[model samples]
Target: MAIFDDEPRKKARPHEIGQDLSLLSVDELS
Candidate 1:
């Protein structure tokens, strides 16, 4: 699926750390 492919792209980039942090905070808060 497209979703599965997109996940690895995000994980592959170090620059994605900022995006990951934002998502992680929201996940933790909820």
Candidate 2:
């Protein structure tokens, strides 16, 4: 219950994790 309450209550869709990383260059990360 706590996990669901804290989280968005939805499973992560495919290809969702790295989308933001793709937008960033190496310099921005460092």
Candidate 3:
């Protein structure tokens, strides 16, 4: 959740879908 919250502050455009993508990427990395 922290990743999703922090991502929007930096990306700030496609938060709708981008948050999911970011979560996936973090999951894969983890």
Candidate 4:
């Protein structure tokens, strides 16, 4: 239910948001 709402919000700004997420993921892993 809540997941559905979050999906569109991300898809709405995928390019910018996606890049940030990728960086965060890498930093967290590193």
Candidate 5:
């Protein structure tokens, strides 16, 4: 039987998501 990769990855926490947004803002402005 072939093993299936069925488990979904967990979402990032609020702090991590915020950090990503900040990085995106910097890139857009520059």
Candidate 6:
């Protein structure tokens, strides 16, 4: 993993969860 991201992406789960939750407030359009 890249510490914040990942290669295969599985490792990015933590990053994704954090960002996704953070973005949720502004992601109402999506």
Residues 5-28, candidate 6: write the lDDT tens digits: 434355444555688866544443
Instruction: After the best TM-score superposition of candidate 2, give how far the Cα of residue 13 lies from its true spot, in angstroms.
Output: 19
lDDT to native, each model: 0.61, 0.41, 0.61, 0.61, 0.43, 0.52
For model 2, which pairs clash? none
lDDT assessment of candidate 1: 0.61
TM-score versus the correct structure, for each prediction: 0.38, 0.24, 0.36, 0.36, 0.37, 0.31
- Please state the error at residue 13 of candidate 4 in Å: 19
Clashes of 5: 0
Error of 2 at 25 (Å): 36
Q: To one decimal, what is the Cα RMSD in angstroms of model 2 from the true structure?
A: 7.8
lDDT of 2: 0.41
Q: By TM-score, who's the top model here?
A: 1
Which parts of model 1 are misplaced by more than 4 Å?
15-30
Looking at model 4, residue 4 earns an lDDT score of 80
Off by over 4 Å in 5: 1-19
Q: Which lDDT tens digits does candidate 3 get at residues 1-30?
A: 999867764565455346687765665455
* Residue-wise C-alpha lDDT for candidate 5, range 1-30, written one tens digit per residue: 122221211123344456798755554454
Model 2 lDDT tens row, 1-30:
879643542333223345555534442343
Which window of ten consecutive residues has the lowest lDDT sum in model 3? 8-17
Of 3 and 5, the candidate ahead on lDDT is 3
Task: Put down candidate 4 lDDT per residue, 1-30, tens digits, no spaces.
Answer: 879866855665555455797765554454
Q: Write model 1 residue lDDT over 1-30, tens digit each, in one string.
A: 889776765564445456697765554454
The weakest ten consecutive residues by lDDT in model 4 span 9-18
